[model samples]
Target: MRQPLFVTALAATAIALAAAANLPEPSADIKAAVAASTRTPANLARDQYRHPAETLSFFGVKPTDTVVEIWPGGGWYTEILAPLTKGKGTYYAASPWPDGNKGVQNKQTADAATYGHVKFAAFPWAEGQPKVPDGTADVVLTFRNVHNWRMGYQRGGTDYSGEAFAQMFAMLKPGGTLGIVDHRLPESASDDREKSSGYIKVSTIRRLAEAAGFEFVGASEINANAKDTADWPKGVWTLPPSLSQKDVDREKYVAIGESDRMTLRFRKPR
Candidate 1:
């Protein structure tokens, strides 16, 4: 039987994006980690779109380097990362506060075997000191978080996004990699959308990273979702995972899967 048009289209998008990203093939350990049983089944199901193994490989994450993940909302990637870096390296989940994310905290206690060694702490906010020691981290990763940083500043008085980049820079070793993945807004979209919509422009992120003294490393489309146009009743959340619109056009948005994302890599000067 012939394949459906939508399926063919999505496959084409993945192919083109992968080519554009120049993503490295996943290392054996990285692939095994992503496939590890420690990861949540729900999170694993999303791997079709997230491509965790390839994405991390693209960022050059290793087993022997200290890694700090900023704002690991509910420990999606944390499930894979914490165990991957165990013993050989360190994994830190830096958020606003540990109490703020009790879900991960409880998981740490309940599943000590996987999360016991993971360090959970506060992110350096509003000129605060970085919880991750300065000049020590080899890789700092943030997934789908840049938009929330914009929201923080737009709603509050602080420039959280700007501060986040600077703080990340402070914690990284020279030649350290800063890997960021977030929903992508079209460059043609009005600037105001960035504050409300969950999507951010690639230029905006590049500007912030460059301002923080990071050298642009490269980009990967390992998480791109072309069906999403970034114009939703509830922004990027209108897609799967959140589906903020509820049953209204549910199938339509579900067909779109996740939001289109820009996977960016930057480096601190050696």
Candidate 2:
């Protein structure tokens, strides 16, 4: 009787192990690329807002999927993605530096060399439509960049942000995923706060994406910062990096760290 019970328990453990093994793992090449890039101890200490392995997994990034990163500023995430998709999958960075912004263009050029298979596509924020092919990308990722569109930062008069969301939906294949991460403001917060604080109410973001014909899947609090009271006079930049109030409230700002972020996942209608 004891032997029979032990055998059953062993079989259950085997089944669990099998399931775990089937789970997707991040590429080692990607990890090495990130390690070799501009990511440093000081950068991690201040701009270490990334949620590591989980963020990639949530986006359903695999070694076999074509991925496009939108507005890959300074190639921060691009460093990890370019090599991951090398050889097996295509990794494309859309949008060159705007108006001869050499600082950003130089960064992209330096980072592009790390992977031989990587490609670049121009993404200009003009009045017309985006040029990304329809139903082409398996994943489209934009980080901390949506508010600019909402506030017409890219260009005046046109709400290119909503148009950008629609373009992403068009660029993704059926059942493909859209991953977004942005600074989060309180739900009760007003539009004035969004313009001033560099943070947007989560509901507004969700509404805009849904309006673009994508399905609202879910969100994660992996990057939540509890210390932020959401009442900094200078807004999100009042925290680290920007530290808008450097002289007046340096100590208070340093203690809060980065702004609270909202991580959201949306899916193109299949």
Candidate 3:
């Protein structure tokens, strides 16, 4: 009877340990950062659709990792990232400098007040200069900037996607991560449409990264939106926020909300 009881106790302990190993930990700090008052209500409202917490988790972001955000347009993610990485980690806004872009200037100013120490790295898009140093970043992230790079490629014949991706790869340490979130176009969409439409195929992006010497880690549906048909009148701009149509089926576009996006992760080989 005593031996049987001992065996049962051991089995229970083993099961408990297994469960604890698999249980998801609370991202309490990240949640608190997102809820911080520094973030505007309009940016906060998009949390339901953006799923920032889950998306960051999928990208394997750590509090102490050195992160570089490529073209942080309007600093939507910057608000969350700046606070989260305030103490230990470094946050670099790798964007165009000396271009007199209001959005970039506004973001840098807001970031200083919000984080106290946000580093700005200049990316000369036209000159194709490498903004970030080699083997420094733990993660390099870009959101909705690929189409713009493609345009630069078309206009300058510099293979902007290839050059930019190689620079990103060079900026990371071995085994470091590259996280990308961009508007997704259907697989059936023509490659040429990427210039006009604010969308790119997943396969095309994967190839770009692979060519730059990064391995495909995985992809997440955290940013996917079923409502997006990818064939809007003014492209992705037809969605909310932009609403380029302006009062033409305004309510209908509002119902559809933001464009569907692809969340992808890649890794530098160790």
Clash count per candidate: 0, 0, 0
Highest TM-score: which candidate?
A: 1
Point out the higher-scoring one by lDDT: 2 or 3.
3
How are the candidates ranked when ordered by lDDT, highest leading?
A: 1, 3, 2
The per-model lDDT (C-alpha) reads: 0.83, 0.69, 0.77
On lDDT, the stronger of 1 and 3 is: 1
Best by lDDT: 1
TM-score of each: 0.89, 0.79, 0.84
Candidate 3 wrong stretches, greater than 4 Å? 1-26, 100-113, 124-130, 153-159
Q: Scored by Cα lDDT, where does model 1 land?
A: 0.83
What residue pairs clash in candidate 2, if any at all?
none
Model 3 misses residue 81 by how many Å? 0.6
Whole-structure CA lDDT of model 3: 0.77
Q: Which portions of model 1 miss their true places by more than 4 Å?
A: 1-21, 125-130, 153-158
- Candidate 2 vs. true structure, TM-score: 0.79
Clashes of 3: 0
